[model samples]
Target: MKTFKKATDPNILKHVNALDNGEITTVSLKHIFHHGSSKYPNLFRRLDVTEENLRTQELASGTSFAYDVMGVNGTGFKYEKDNAVEEFRNISMNELKSSKLDWRDIGKWLPAIKNWGTLINLAKMTYNAYIEMGQEDWYDLGEEYSTNNTFGWEEDGIRGYVFASSDNKTLIISIKGTSMGFGAGPTVPRDKENDNLLFSCCCAKVDRTWTPVCDCYKGGYSCDKTCLQDSVDGESLYYGITLNLVNSIYHEYPNSHIWLTGHSLGGALSSLMGLTYNLPVVAFESPGERKAASLLHLPHPPAIPWDKMNIYHFGHTADPIYMGSCNGFSSSCYIGGYAMETKCHAGIACTFDTVSKLKWSVNIKRHRIQEIIDNILKVWWNLFKLFPDCKNDDECEDCGLWEYIE
Candidate 1:
């Protein structure tokens, strides 16, 4: 049986220290994840991203504990039917790649700029990501203002969607979050007849065929760096889609301001894609993990080219799903794995201080995208309603959800 451990416990403190050690980076993760594997095998097992193991954990937990895993893999796998439609005129832009963000300058500006309009746009995208819609749904979203969405592609192992403003100026690409499905991210092992090719992690890739440090899902995470590289390499499911999207977009949109957004694991993908595209991104409740060795050129925290790209992460400080805060809370072990050590390195955080109002108690409700959106909308309304013109105009025309007429 699992029991709660104090945050100060030596076993947990080491990881906490390592995560916040300032020196840690994706480069450092190469050492830490493998070297520290022995120390947190149990933690890794709990994080196993496979259908079978997650199913076991869900049954043991007596609830749906692996929803995030499902979101990442289900749609990704379901859509990879080799059906390649040339819908996206620019396949490169449609298939953007994923990269890590510059976390160093994230807080350089102090309190985040509360541009309600940007928040509303991000919130709408978050809603689209959460509800799992296609292009037509976005077109018929019933909003007065103009917004357009296009279905990208689901070939190889990539399943994502794209959208843009009415003028087709500020282009926004959104990836769907982890899907809820019967078989989450699972890999069918390569048998003698299978030639080492297998499907896992929401995409198709060659099996690492190495012994994992901890117990595993169908497709496993192991210390064999070479095999690991191949697992998520060019032929890897998600990255292939991302690469194609980037190639298409880079060639077509020579000067468009590209933006990316997603929630959960989708948020992770958005961050990766933003880095790959070197553009602005807004992510909701993303788990932190290491970039593949091939992306070593990506900059580390405290030294990012802010002028080139900007990233906004809106995770409630109390949400373990965003970062790890479960060391003291036994119930949150699955958050970013058992030790809850997964670390996110996105740009400046537009965080909500949920723990403060709750008297320092943690609640998962703060992690909900809709909940965050509701709060953002409220802040906008309160500020807009304070205007003398807005409040005094008793005969003002209804502006839909806006507090004042445009």
Candidate 2:
């Protein structure tokens, strides 16, 4: 368990606003998790934050904080899928081994959901992870003080960053989202595959002319439920890889408080991880993943109250993806080879009414993490001086028009 000391920089302090009139604390990049397209597909690298790797700057609220900006390299641990599966099965016992949603353990690992400040910090951390791929320093460009910590992996498979508080008490797992626009990246194929598999109803079967990612679509609006479940549980996919990552992290940091956050696809994966382990999650502008959770057969555990869960979705009305309005062949998501058909998110939604209150029109451009930070989250509270209440949407329905045939 490596730890870092609290060393605040005056320059960082000047740029950042005081959080609740107190100095903003920072988190350190402890490890980088990567899977697929390598000798060790499932790789974990441990790194320490040094002065050169550490950057401090202004962010949301009157709060300023620091984060590590280090290059990704080094091998710590390699994850073996067969062994992990065997171990998870043995531990699950009678519980759903495939889903890993042992309801008996629900609410046992809830994260400390303190206030909006905590959520804002988590969002910033998520942004840090998302922008690391571009390798451009937002702080250097005077776009507010945000750190860029490059963690390189093969253009294929899944990757995420592990950030820890100075005290080593809390750890935030930040997942990367879809990176396909303009030109295609190496991961675009797999990224699109996962998006279609996880977010779409019936393997992204929009119409007869469309090609389904999986053979779950029976015909018309009918889908084979068994086939859908099987496709979602494929070990090589992003969801399964994410489950493995969460399990590894849980064992590695048993005593530390762990939370998950991400934007877009990353956010949806974070929410799924939160459900699997009953940990805390804060997803930003993500399409609804509740329907995907159902297909994965995640535990609802009747005894657990919805309020007791620590999953939170933060987004606004402007983003069509977040609003569940982006679908059909003409929609941006569909045109981009994505079937973002789900819109019923799990847990509480802490959403801002940017369309109604701020009079912003719904648009796909607003789905970017930077847009959320600069236009909505950063400005919403500053102008209104209050946050929209986070509430449960258990009644929300997804894929209402489709039928899942058993």
Candidate 3:
């Protein structure tokens, strides 16, 4: 029986100490996600692109008993789920790859559920994926800190971390997001390449002065549909690399319940990975990947509907990137060379009304994962007693004005 009780606040120092002392089990995942200008693989796996907007019902809300799993115990956060959705929760990578050939005819991928405690824990794990050990360990580190030996996070490295519960019943894969602005590092250029490719309406084509990331732009608001599709499926892209990584992790722990979580670009990748393999995901402040998903032609369940999908996007309103308003020539994202235009996220969106409830103004600085973790989630109970409403982004749309031509 899975019982989640009220969880105590996570102690960052203790967790870090345990990790360094080998008390906490952790795995560092390193991969070269991108190839140089000419080293990219020539083979591309394409999914038949399709436009879909299948409306479906949501699961009923409920409360979970806080159960100890990762050493934290307390009354679990609010949740909603339908037991019927469980049967479709797990899918093999081979099955997914084969099904992608005719992705539109695919079966369900996620359970109809959302849990606040699970989401918060996933967020903490994602936060830990960003810790750069000796560099920013003291930069407001709490609940989750870095361990140089087991969980050392590189500011500019394209890597992931795997955490296994003490009992080995559950495993978590945390992917690192772009490390720019907060800490500009070696991976900034490649990270920006992916951010633009995945989120931008065209290819980060903002204005006349901006250099488009790909050749898909065909002057004006027109973009080559085929070219754009090919651009995202490149093996060197982070999505493909992360896909392989997740597949490997899944094969290693076939029977364990695995989850994916990340912030910003990492969050977007996590959602995409969840969509592909039908794993549960909790993405924080992720830009809408619907456009990228559409271009990639990833599979979608025909009967189950989207709200029932297990992926949950948890973010506040003060973030322009997550809100999809961080564009235009004068915006901070433009100045920083980021094209975070896609706003409609996949699965369910659990957004905190920070603008109205907390009286916070929308700002790019708020896009930082640390801001969400330290300023908001840690003191959530004091600020609000219950989790925000989690619902489908049925009305959300992306790149409505841009025209993709064949």
Candidate 4:
């Protein structure tokens, strides 16, 4: 939101024009601030251009324009060390070699690949956490959630499954696929067995033909009638799921806190539910549903503020799905090459590798997944540090060790 005084400065002008025309060069961007001197003495001070910023801008612009951004924070190298880049590259190559099928084939294989990959990743992370905690009797919640259907529901065209802990205090709802349907409610004791947790999983009925209702549909500045209906339907279904769970809990325990979570499209829906219903959500790899939510407002009551919302968007630098249209709700603080610092070596490596992978793959899905993974990894690493580790649990400490490296 900061306005640049050198908006008209020749150097800045050159860079902007070059970017607009799809010819922005590194030299031009680096020297953009040096255009106006005496007339705009503070121009250079206010308009220093960097590789990361350039990438952020490019991402905001939906990669339609060309910009050369460098990865200063060892993120570039970490990608290699983590082998995430190699894995993605291999996946893309394999997909391409096996691209003899049509879109229908792709649609089928894509979901399977994603679901399997997610299961594997979740298992690995859970196992590692278990090892770190050194708990032998720890329940393998991830495995249980993956296989069990103890807590499940189907109502109002929404179907969901649940995963709860032994304490019944924590709940995690996972909505699979791209539908708005999901499960709800607490776990019922099965024939004298007491329930420890309450969980639900749900997915929307993916109307492949159900185009996203937004201004894009009507070429307007606000939500059209159809768009509003779509938003309401989606939002209402999400709220219904949460309320059912809460109502069920109130009937039994009378006091419980619920945590919501989802992935990709589910993440977006979960965020919508959290913001509207005042629920705390921990969504992963969610795309921004801000546009729709913003359009619909909060039905009758206003939603929580941005600060109060505990939504964590986990995404990799290479994932294009997360990198939605630059003009949408997903545009806020979307870190790109600019925010990838070396101190956060993981971020730097992932960003660089993601960019490289994007350039090579050019496949939309691959690029999107890679980017989401990179970003999610960065966030996870930081979050992991928050728990009591060998290091200090000091609060309000500045963790920007990689800021200067870029």
Candidate 5:
């Protein structure tokens, strides 16, 4: 700890000071190296880290995109698997093991990167989250996560579920997106009675409903800005409810860590909530959440490091929702006539493509969380074999245990 020094850049130093004073959360620390580099270029140059070293640093440092998670010749995204059973089966427990060298090493998590089972399970949980929202009745879930887990579940009216097992030290918060089956209009009614927990959206007549308020989230197509506040972690009423739910669960299970998963709108919410709490987050086929990140005044890329607050953002080439298939509003719709930047995608992204056979898939079908899962299942072979195998423990040891299997 003594080896680390205060950053020289004032802007970054401010956040670091806030972090020390507990004014801001740890999530604010992600991608914080620019401060050091900007103010200490000479010192940085003297340190002499090579590109190879830099690439290696990123896998565990959370500085690069998902594609860079595993170096061109390392673990993480560079890892791969085959079929559901085999994908989870042959993986060595060694891959999930953690080491001191890894920066944001979550010592005992099985779903870090290459763990297909965890990814699939979370994807399934995303489905359960949807089912929790779409089903007219609470108990109508099918092949979904059980509400009967050890500590049972907490339903947010129709917003999401907090799955907890009394014996386990980690809890999962699964969120549901825009499609509410029981609602009258396609749009989510921001009624006071509902606590404004849902995004104001409608699955039908989407174009006419006029969504997409931001760019990258581009063009400022705000879903619901009124429910939000003016400071860090000050999310809309929806996430406020989620934050409380998570806090209550955390209070009861004081020793547990939190994991978040969701699809579409839920995914976006998870990103926001995860950032708010500095928890590990994995979202499927979700849009870039600029507004949410705005509250934190998120720094440039790598705002939340994969090693610290791990976020795995999975998207496919065919998903138009996140990839801007529909595009955002015109410049006029944004605040101050300035189009909002939609590229506020946090963490390491795990973006890939599954062939979309349908003509409309470029915009719709492919964006489905199920479709992304289906593609992963369909192509279950290890993806990162392009790199050389680890000859020994020293060559491959890192806190994050992901195999770069080809």
Candidate 6:
């Protein structure tokens, strides 16, 4: 007869901590049962049985208790049969070459414009800023912007704004930044007054990839047909510059982690980059472009591997962009939640957080960038710690599923 132990024994935490710290190599059912039986005999008694019988009993229980303690038989704890990483390696090298293919082809398929009336007003604001700033001020502003990175003119007639840190490990390709919506300042404030506008502008890029490829727009719709026409042309120019930046990065850092991020209009473009190039993204409060892009037959997020990507959305709860049914789709639609231990997917991962209610607002803002970097570091640390014993064939080899994967 199999013996059982109490789970609540003080030694349980000790053993768990040891497993976490890599201090123990092989833990047995006996030790786990001993710990459980000592504290919770009612729970541990069920474990005093054969492995096959226990598995069957757990499944037949159909109670949350079994699932909470022992993972689902064929789903959660079971190892992944398909080797996604190995498959990605093979596909990435040949079919998904980072170079040689024109990602802009995918960009061209997006909707030309979404919510045009909102976009035209944004353009008017930008044009007014250009007029107020004057030529010298405009040039000076461009210079200031360029100071953060070099400016490059692409063959497709669109100018590029490339920003790289001194270490050159990270590169931000602003295919179309704030300047795309309105030429100069007072550039929309980074706060609420300008946040919606910024988001609307980014929707243009999403439009380019996901929106309909049609040239006609009837009046009375929320979108501006005239602005849509202009955006179609603008996206073409932006795509050229983006491709140039991708090429530049390929030459500059052959083996560095690359992330493409953008706000509002830039977010849409960044999403396109992630989809077309298979590069990972960190987009902020971006609207749904995938719906529109899917209309153009563009691939969805599931097509991409989960490990190489994460899309983080920092949304202010009151932001108007998330309120309405933009792109003919409601914003409040709920995708099912995942277990914390499930692996993430390759495509978009949306995380929504209300920025106004945080306790440490000031500290968080000042250290926001560093906080993100630190979180990423912690993820890597935990992954290494947990996966040390994981062999290539181990189930769910990756440490945890990120938002995107879930």
Most accurate candidate by TM-score: 2
Worst 10 residues of 6 by lDDT: 67-76
TM-scores of all candidate predictions against the true structure: 0.48, 0.75, 0.69, 0.36, 0.48, 0.35
Model 5 Cα lDDT, one tens digit per residue, 265-327? 678768766655555678887765643454333321232234344566777656655553323
What digit string (tens of lDDT, one per residue) describes model 1 on residues 25-128?
Answer: 00000000000011111110001123464355446644332111000000000112212212211232233333322232222111112334444455555555
Q: Cα RMSD for candidate 3?
A: 13.6
- How high is the lDDT of residue 168 in model 4? 37
Query: In model 6, how large is the Cα lDDT of residue 288?
Result: 42
lDDT of 3 by residue, 1-406 (tens): 2222232345432222222221222222221121122122221111111111001100111211112223221111111232222222222122322121221222222211233334455666676566432222222111232222423133232546565544445566778887777555656777888899999999899888889889999988899987988898777687777776677667767876676778999889998887767677778999888778767766444433574456888898888888888433337566478888888888888888889888889888898887877777766656776566678876877887788897
Q: Arrange candidates, best lDDT first.
A: 2, 3, 5, 1, 6, 4
Q: Which scores higher on lDDT, 1 or 2?
A: 2
Clash number for each model: 26, 2, 12, 38, 28, 35
lDDT of 6 by residue, 162-279 (tens): 3333344333343333322233232222212122212222222222223322333332223443343243333223332344445555455665444455544345546656654555
> For each candidate, what is the lDDT?
0.37, 0.66, 0.61, 0.28, 0.40, 0.29
327 Cα displacement, candidate 6 (Å): 5.4
Which parts of model 4 are misplaced by more than 4 Å? 1-157, 179-231, 234-254, 299-304, 326-353, 356-362, 367-406
| Per-model C-alpha RMSD | 21.9, 9.7, 13.6, 26.8, 21.8, 24.0
Best by lDDT: 2
The regions of model 3 sitting more than 4 angstroms off are 1-118, 132-157, 301-304, 327-332
For TM-score, candidate 1 versus 3, the one ahead is: 3
